[model samples]
Target chain A: MKTLLITLTIALASLSALAQGVKVGDKAPDFNLKNVDGKMVALSDYKDAKGAVVIFTCNHCPYAQAYEQRIIDLHKTYAAKGYPVIAINPNDPAVQPQDSYELMQQRAKDKGYSFAYLFDEGQLVYPKYGATKTPHVYLIQKRGADFMVEYIGTIDDNYKDAAAVKEKYLADAIDALIKGDKPTLVNTKAIGCSIKVKK
Target chain B: MKRFVIYMLLVAAVAASCTRGERPTGELAVPIVDYSGLEPYLNKSNDTTYIVNFWATWCTPCVEELPYLEKLSREYSNGPVKVLLVNLDFPKYYDSRLLPFLKEHDITAQVIMLDDSDTNTWINKISPEWQGSIPATVIYRGTKRQFFERAFTYEELVEIVEEF
Candidate 1:
């Protein structure tokens, strides 16, 4: 019985640790990383703005690639109002053959991204945001001086078929914030490639 | 001179052995079938509960939850419960990832790589709310199947396995 208790404890602890990933109501982690332009960017940099859209992304991962255009559209639509999409690459190029700095630049330049494409070298920022996959998005809204994640989830309900899109989770969340209302679906799931880290 | 030659040959032998690639393929990797394809593998009379975990090599939570799933499989082996892992590692993870990953860990449950094109057709086909999330699981007993997202604990797993 004692052994079983210990096993149970270990299992719970492990799950708890593994599940450190934040949910909808969790506070967004603060981070500062060098963007593609070699300029330092921080979550606080956007403090003066109404809110920010924090997204984990990379050069590889077909799933992430699939949302690239949609993400661009989101930034184009919302940056003027308040929320600016901050795309962060969480993969360590040292481990991921496809996520090298050079490839990232090529991808960004080719895609004509207007948002900040920061590199999370060593993945110091991803875990804090509780991000699990590429293209994972967290919407942070600035209430007073602090920021909290308002909506966390997929870009939209349609990655497979944009023509058949029925729901727009991120877009709706931003719209809710604009209307001074909290988003209804704050936490949603995204399917994408895993972020690779170097040992 | 004789001793030096012997040492060189021994070093050469060691290097050759070390470089000889992953273990000889043991059990053939099971293919992750679509919802329609899953019909053949499932026994209709099986009142025994079955947990089918959908995972991939690149997915952190999926990889992390493997051992716990293995334990669940072990527990079920003693009774009318079963666990099957559907690996979404895809074909890309085979050489650069899966084979090496399998060799590094001691895995006991059956592992399958689901190679399906056009995820759109299958996402809803598997379950309406899948949302393409990895580390999701589908638990079944007879005609009933309960789907769960997120990783599992041994106790939580046991509870689900024994529920039916």
Candidate 2:
């Protein structure tokens, strides 16, 4: 009985810790989430690419709105260079109606989004990635058939004005990776709207 | 009687002018500060429990929970609880968005605007557990501090403050 109780306690502790989600150097989880185009997109679909710039964002967040153009610019600049931005909407539509799939399709069409705007139906993908807010970024690199999380955080230092940005953290990390060097900064933080979910 | 009437008129004119002078210009002034300026509020060594909420005008959850914070402030006004709302709205929207929201919501709690662009540094300093999400709160009484990365209801807030 004593041994069983100890095992149960450890298991519960680790389960709670797992709720925090993935970290740097961990193998990134792949999902077949539905895209705005009605096709299912998966990380494995980008097997030929060097890495993927995965960003959790939605339509209603002001912070996400601020970075929308920047995200488009990132895909424009880096997609050809082998890192494509895979945008995901991880909010439950019931919690936030504006982030519903129909609006997501409309927003993508209106904005002319250059990348896949996938919806994490049932809200599964973000919890594995430990995404707490919209505009959270996770840069994953392909390493011997495994996608390893290289960097996790925001797009840059200045979310409000991209022109006035001093530190391009995401760009710098991608640049270092292309040059076959480790990123000096592996993680960062920025204020964003919390990922909406129902109780 | 004529002298008395003249003196009364002069007094009324002076009173009206003073009232006009004291009237607010309709422009709400919220102090803007960097992370350095905000650090002192987070680390006060006093007996009063300070509930510092990091929020913005645009964040939905933050806006949704503002009334609870206001209620908490109102209930604890004469007590040792001090609620400080730290707003993170963009500087460009200060006039266009933030002020209007503040006015519309009738937020009477002490508000301070945080204008720092270096979020990576200050975010960790606020709390390592915070992953840079708004609607996050820090309730502290001197060195005994608790950080919440989620929104709170009035009852939950009251329970926490009571314990503090």
Candidate 3:
């Protein structure tokens, strides 16, 4: 019984740690979520790809809205090259009505998004990735059967003006991965709206 | 009696001027300042605890938490705390959005515009734990500081300030 108690304690401790989600160099976790097109999509669906640009963004956030065109352009530029932009709206609709699945679908159609925009329903996927804010980017590259968290944080240095962006962090990371090399600048941060999770 | 009437009129005019100082009339000029003008406010060597809140006009949670910050500033008016609302609104939106929002809310805390876009380098300089999210706040007394990246209730905000 004493040994059982110790084993249980260790199990709970590890569970709490896993709850904090993935970090750099860690194996990226996979999820089967519904896309804006009413079809189910998963990271495995992009099995043929070299890497993935998993972006947590929402329709309501001004920061996310500002990057919409940039994100669309990223998908257009990289989808044919094996690294595609996988947009995810991690915000709970109950908390932010504008980020609801219906609105997400509308935004995807209206914006002419060429990539898979998934909805993290029941608020499951984001916390597993430890996503803190909208417009947060996690670049994952597949190695063997597992995808590794190569880079985490923002898309670029500037969110206000895409033309003014000096450092394209996401594009740079993807380019390096394509060349079988590590990114020169791995991680970055930018002022973004906090992910609207349900209370 | 004539001298007394003149003195009362002078006092009334001086009182009106003081109120004007708190809030300027006509088109209010929102000072657009860079990090140089802001460094002094953050690096004060005095005993006052500075509660610096980073916010933008478009950020929902930031706007939601603004009231709590405003309230805390008022409650701690005579105390050792000073609240500074650093507006991170885009320079283009300063006249169109930010200034109008400030005027509409009648925000009492000291507000200033931060125009720098090199956030990746400076975010860590502000706080290592900051994820560069709005509604983030830094409470500091001299060099000792604490940074919170999430929204805070009035009670939660006061709890932190009172602890310092």
Whole-model Cα lDDT of every candidate shown, in order: 0.77, 0.92, 0.87
TM-score list, all predictions: 0.63, 0.88, 0.86
Clashing pairs in 3: none
What DockQ does every candidate get? 0.14, 0.68, 0.61
Models ranked on lDDT: 2, 3, 1
B1-164: candidate 1 lDDT, tens digit per residue: 99999999999999998776544556555554544666444445566777788887766657778888988778678677777787766565566777678667767787776665445456556677565657788887777977776677788887766665
Cα deviation at B120, candidate 2, in Å, is 0.7
lDDT of 1 at A123: 80
Q: Give per-residue CA lDDT, model 2, range B1-164, as digits (tens).
A: 99999999999999998865342666447777899989998999978999999999878788889999999999898778899999998888776787789899989999999999889989999999899988999999988999999989899999999988
Model 2 chain A lowest lDDT segment of ten: A14-23
Cα-based lDDT at residue A90, candidate 2: 95
Candidate 3, backbone clash total: 0
- Please tell me how candidate 1 rates in CAPRI terms: incorrect
Candidate 2 or 3, higher TM-score? 2
DockQ for model 2?
0.68
Whichever of 1 and 2 has more DockQ, that candidate is 2
lDDT of 3 at B118: 80
For residues A20-102, write the lDDT of model 3, one tens digit per residue.
Answer: 97888998889999999899999988889988999999899888888899999998998888889999999888889999999
Question: Cα miss at A135, model 1 (Å)?
Answer: 1.6
The CA lDDT at B20 in model 3 is: 53
